[model samples]
Target: MNYLKEYNELTAICPKTYIKYSEPMENHTFIQTGGIADIYIKPKHINDVQKIIRYAKMNEIPLTVLGFGTNVIIRDKGIRGIVMNLEYLNDITVNENEIIAGCGASIIDVSRTALKHSLSGLEFACGIPGSVGGALVMNAGAYGGEISYVLKNAKAITLSGDILVLNESEFEFGYRKSIFQKENYIILEATFQLINSDPAEIREKMDTFTALREEKQPLEYPSCGSVFKRPPNHFAGKLISDSGLQGTRVGGAEVSKKHAGFIVNVNHATSTDYLMLIQHVKETVKQNFDINLETEVKIIGEE
Candidate 1:
């Protein structure tokens, strides 16, 4: 494929935007194990985002949108066509008890910003390692707090270049889902409604959560945060740990002894190795407990 020519055409339309051809998905993903993306883009402005979408639509190119790559896995054959990463669009601002943040802004950073402003609602997000956009899409939460609880509204651009502002009710938030997953809308920004609190109290809560994450999770390795979603009345980690699947290895990928919920890349683990280990864990857990395990991580691209 003459990806350079396509890159040239894309560059012509989305001028000054950073674009690359045959970019390695491993470098962009948190797991660091995937093939190449045909074209990778980082748009600096919302205008560029609109232009890229229009170009991709007109050319019939497959467009894959990526956040900060914290909780996703890209397959070995990589993603074809254009992959847009909303990294440079990050910007955060605070107004009294409300926070207005770009979709690309780090959720962790946003939480910190809340603490700095003495906001209490985002303390649950203190340890989340995803973009605000991705967190909202999946309704990411921990320690009894979810994005849906604090979200006011969100700004999104449709595939047809139409802008829409959706309120909290329209999000359809659930355990780990929102309308964004089913709709072809590109999230632009989000507004959060928070409560004013003592900076000391917020910091104490943030510190506690951070300490707990470090103690319980395998923070010293490369892996998607948590591999499986919690079952109806059972915890995925407890099931895997009880099934004696900890420290199990598939190639360089291993189920972390520290947290059975996480599959870590202890060595040069490929996407295949990671995936195979996940399957093994699921099957073993299902066989032992008669419960099916669904993944929390978003797996994309080709096989």
Candidate 2:
């Protein structure tokens, strides 16, 4: 929709920043399989983020804010309008047991910060590959800890450029869901409360979780980590494995042999390949058993 013209207008407001026309989504995503975006921008400042959002809202242009890519699939035909990436907002600071983290800060980095300072609560997140904002938006958790438990509050910018400080309860977090998912809110920074612990203990815990993830998950391949959420009492991986879908391939997208839950890009897989492979596995599992596997990963963009 003449994104070039819109991009020119945007640069007039927020100049001297990273902006790209027809930027490849594959370069931004973890799975490395997506189409070109009409306009992709990485705002340098919070005011820049606000200005972009306000501009999009004022002009009735579509806007999609993204963090460090994980747990999302951008479709093969690409996304329309502006794709605002928050990767450059990364900053992290510690204040005793409280950690102030920018939306773009990696969850792993936060965990490491906790370890560095002998904080304990973030040890469970040592293996996650999401940014702070993405984790907050999704309530991302691992090894029995979720963002809801540790989050004190978050600074978010509304679509109209108003700032809102959301408390933990406002997050409405549950099983990979949060208010940010339902509302037009862009996370700016997150405050988390952790606990003091022995440095050795924290390091040991982080190391253990890291080793476990490396051992069980298909870390060697390019893929969305876990394709499906655990349904009821059944584990997603066990269900896929029991359905005999392990090592199943669809145009270079293969259900991981090591971990059935992962769909890896074994070859130069397309977005269609991943989506098709996910559908095939879902159908097979549903056919073999009665359970319908709901995807944990968010799929976006167009066909």
In terms of lDDT, model 2 sits at 0.90
- Model 1: colliding residue pairs: none
The TM-scores, one per candidate, come to 0.98, 0.98
lDDT of 1 by residue, 76-181 (tens): 8999999999978799999999999999999999999999988989999999998999998999999989999999999999887778999977998899988988
Off by over 4 Å in 2: none
What lDDT does the true structure give each of the candidates? 0.92, 0.90
Report lDDT (Cα) of residue 74, candidate 2.
90
State the lDDT of candidate 2 residue by residue for 1-303, as single tens digits.
778899899878888779999999999999998898888999878999988988999999889888877888899999999999998889999999999999999999999988888888988899899899999888888888888889999999888899999996688888888898878689999999999989998888888888999999999999878999989988999999999989999998999999999999999999999999899988988898988999998898865
User: Could you tell me the TM-score of candidate 2?
Assistant: 0.98
The best candidate by lDDT is 1
Deviation from native of the Cα of residue 64 in model 2, angstroms: 0.9
